[model samples]
Target: MNSFTQYIQQLFANEVGGLFAAEPAPLREARQKSMDFFLAHGLPTRKMENWRQCPIDGLVQSDYRMQREADPYRPVEEYFQCQVRNLATQMFPFLNGWFVHPDAPLTKSANGVITGSVAAAVKQCPELILPYLTTTHADKADRGLVALNEALFNDGLFIYIPANVKVEEPLQLVSMINTDDNLLINNHNVIVLGENASLSFVHCDDSIKYGKTLINNVTEVHLAPNAVMHYYKTENKDADSLLVNHLFVRQQENSEWVSNVVTFNAGYIHNAIHLDLDEPFAHANLYGLYLVDKSQVVDNQVFVAHNAPDCSSYQMYKGIADDSARANFNGHIVVRQDSQRTQAYQTNRNMALTDEAVVTTHPFLEIYADDVKCSHGATVGQLNEDAMFYLRSRGIGERTARMLLMYAFANEVTDKVTIDSLRERLANMVERRLSGELTLCDQCRLHTSDGKVLIFDVDPDKI
Candidate 1:
């Protein structure tokens, strides 16, 4: 095995640590079970189907590190504080995989919404969380990295929206990593939305310090009958970090699940999203956008399973690569024989801003049902030379013209955010990444026509 693999093996050599250690009886048992699974399986490699394109060679070569016991830096505190003030929704903040403020106010009168650190929630409401805290490796059976996470994750946020409740505010879970120690860090989150409930969640991943660190994160989401869920994710880990995020979602009859994944910064990133439509009329809309610069590498693998009849799924992903960065988008849609009348569409579009930039797209559709509407396509090319020339003729500089064109290219996916504040935030993030700005204030401001500033609705569930 390579050095990365050996490093992971050594990190979780015998046991798991962090939040799982203090859990009560049953959960403690489950935690132990998950830990055992990880010690047996280990980290993923290029051989795994889901990880075929994004190899974990670099991550496995490093030692598993932990953040310092005390908070030595404050990179995201201002953002979280701003979110708390401007966002009308409930907010949960985690820094370096640990809950910084355990006493944050919760709008308890806001119906049946449960939001808190996954580990704390278990300690406080074990019975309420017992059923939903399993690892993503449940099916992979051999995913070593996921197992390792289950064994050693420090803190993760858990959210649940009960039946018929519509949360107006967007629930925000922000996770920040500080490379205090030089070992691997594992984090996990579990979210569940009950029947007819509508919920929106955003996960923001950022980091402080510069070191060779690894992040293995797993998230599980369940949408019950007629439920609606909207999810947005942003990853901006430092250049020396390696991040692996796995998301598993299940949808029931008439449920709607929408997801937007934005990867603007990272040294090496791999995102895996799986959606299982287990009941009739379930629908999934997936959109992804990635902007990579320098020598960064980003990979996305998504699988949508149509197991029931009359299900509809749509996927559109776009990538913009500059410098020597590389990106890969792989989309797989499968329609089973029992899933008649299934309608699925998948598309991947990529633009290489520089000659050295590279992108690979694979959109596949496998169908066993005769009466199904399934289509998949991918396109990889350079910026529209014609468009560039046309814009330049209007006095726009080459760099500015190219940035605008690139923004418009990614606008298709950003427009799907639905949440105005999120759209604005995502736009600013895109702009900042393209322009190499790390501070949000330096990012362009977005406002509606009425002059009412649109802040990311943190309490989306409250609305």
Candidate 2:
């Protein structure tokens, strides 16, 4: 066995029982199965088709501790602050790999929505949590990194919405990695919505410590018939951080699902998403945006499966890279033989700001049904020189003209966000990021370089 695989097995053998005693029996069994799978398959290498472009040799070779406790020197609340102005939200914080209750009491709504730590919910509502804990979208084949997550994840958020309920405000979950020690973190979350229910969820990832660390996170979402859900994810970690995030969704008849992934900074980051349209008339929309520079790498992999007739799916992703950065996008759509009258479309566009920047895109469609309509396209190029000259001719400065064009390119994905405040916040942040005025540690006070917090005014017209 490889050293990495042996190290993971030893870690699990040493602490699996003591660390996860609160989990239900079914969950424990799942963990054991996952451990076995990981040991057998080990980690993926360059030979694998899906992981060829993205390399993880350095990440796997490093020695990282499994953090189970928060750092005693720093308070967790020092890292939990709102980035969006005037946006009232129920917040839950996950530090390292464990859930930490916020300073303010978490809102308990009268609409029968339960939100708290996943381990606590497993003990309180085993019937509801056990059925879907690790059962939905179970893959029987080789899934190296996912199996590792199932075996090692300690705690994350759990949100349950009852039938016929609509949440008025957005629910936010902030996950932070702050420690002086080198660490590897594993976290898992579950979100379920009942029939005719609707909810908006925002997930954010940040870091305060400058040390190198690896974060592995997994989230599963289920929507009942006639339900609607909107999900938004933002990543703004330090340049030394490594991240792997997985998101899975299952939709019933007449349900609607929309998700957006916005990435600002990271050293090596990979995002994998899977959507299953299980019943008739279900629809899904997937969108993503990433900005990277200075040797940073970002990869986005998406899969959509049409299992029922009359279902639809759409995907759009845009990225910008400069100074030897790399960006990768791979989107796959499959229509089963029994599924008829399916509609799907995908598009990927990227801009390279420097000669050393690299961007790769692959959009694939596999159809076993005759009565399906699907299309996909991808483009990679620099900013339009003609348009730049046109704006320059009008007396606009070169730097301002370039920033304006880049902002216009990224605004296409930002404009699709339904939350008005969040959309405005993203627009402002993107403008600052493109102009090289934004710092990587803007949200955390401990890492601010100048000792004074920097804030930007939101301009709705810019978007």
lDDT of 1 by residue, 252-334 (tens): 99999999999887689988898999999999999999988888889999999999999999999999988999899989999
Instruction: Give lDDT tens digits, candidate 2, residues 46-91.
Output: 6666676776655665478988654443344443467586777777
Which ranges of candidate 2 are over 4 A from the true structure? 70-79, 102-108, 136-142, 444-463
Worst 10 residues of 1 by lDDT: 439-448
Q: Candidate 1: misplaced stretches above 4 Å?
A: 1-29, 67-87, 104-110, 436-463
lDDT of each: 0.74, 0.82
Residue 82 CA displacement from its true place in model 1, Å: 4.2
Q: Positional deviation of 352 in candidate 2, in angstroms?
A: 1.9
Per-prediction TM-score to the true structure, in the order listed: 0.86, 0.93
Task: Please give the lDDT score at residue 299 for candidate 1.
Answer: 93
